[model samples]
Target: MSFINKMLPNVSLIWPDVWQATLETLYMTIVSAIIAGILGLALGVWLVVTDQNGITPHPVTYNILDKLVNIFRSIPFVILLTVIYPLTKAIVGTSIGNTAALVPLVVGTIPFYARQVQTALVQVDPGVIEAAQAMGASNVDIIFRVYLREGLPDLIRVSVLTLISLIGLTAMAGAVGAGGLGNLAVSIGYQRYQSDVTIVAMLIILVMVFLVQGIGDWLTRRTTHV
Candidate 1:
């Protein structure tokens, strides 16, 4: 109780800022996630479809996209941020805020999510896809209904993974003055030696990760049947 009392004042003073940072983090994560999810899913489907033995194989296209995805994914994100800073500045008109942070966040996450989507889609039953094709289903129909539907659980699982990763990336965005819990921890907590603040920020991030994991598990279970 005494410790709680001692902490209350500081908590009260910082809580609003913390909450704001959290919201900024969430905004960046969600916006980027949605964009990445859609584009990555399409890219993943393209990768699969254009592979040597796929439904519509195209060696050249597949190889190109494959190399592109690999190349982007290979770049360390810290370097990616600096590499894309000009694009970020051009797009957002400033390279140092939550909005500007979205550029690298999306670029970093898209390749990751695309690979996950490819893996998940590949795991879908080929027989099911064949059956859909036999029924004269269009390519789009087979993709959405067969590939996506069958891969829902894995997609959710990977999405949870991606979202958690984005949280960490958002923190890194703070390096460019994109304020979030990461920025708060680094700028105020670490720089000022406010251990309590750092601890609290870490705890909050941990709680958020666990919550996302729990939701992913529940969704995966719900999509599966005994």
Candidate 2:
């Protein structure tokens, strides 16, 4: 105990705050990731299914969704926080807390996850899809049993990637007003010259990222038969 304190001299002072911040960060990341994942999956599937080469080609629909995804994905997250401030405030009734941070987090992640989903789905063998169709499979059946099933491994990989990215964004959210490790590190740690605090916060984040990655790899391997 004494030796640990000697190393992170200031951590004990704000240990409670650090713990709270960790919870807040997890809350924002998990909630937002879930919402974004569902929405992004829908959008992604739409993109694949409505494309020129899709099961139901609709060039107009594909172009519009494609452009929207590109536009949102290209925006810097920091700028996105500001750009969507009004929407955040309107929806959550405030724009400076962990809950409020969820709006932008979901918005920012959706397009990115959507693109990842699209990529994974596209990698599903076209020949396999054709076979399913020839076997009198409905579009819905092909989507569920073939596209999603075969692409499960890649989807899991991309989901891990998105989750890790969302965790980083939660840190950035802390810089502005979201109460998380990022806020603790930047607002109290860095600004107050508490180097130990900054290090602790960063270490926690790294652990979180690694855990997500490890779990993702295990799931991918388990699902991947071929």
Which prediction has the highest lDDT against the true structure? 2
Worst 10 residues of 2 by lDDT: 5-14
Q: Given candidate 1, what's the lDDT at residue 193?
A: 83
Report lDDT per candidate: 0.86, 0.96
lDDT of candidate 2 vs native? 0.96
- Over 1-226, each residue of candidate 2 has an lDDT whose tens digit, in order, gives 8898899889987889999999999999999998999999999999999988789999999999999999999999999999999999999999999999999999999999999999999999999999999999999999999999999999999999999999999999999989999999999899999999999999999999999999999999999986
Model 2 TM-score is 0.99
lDDT of candidate 1? 0.86
TM-score of each: 0.94, 0.99
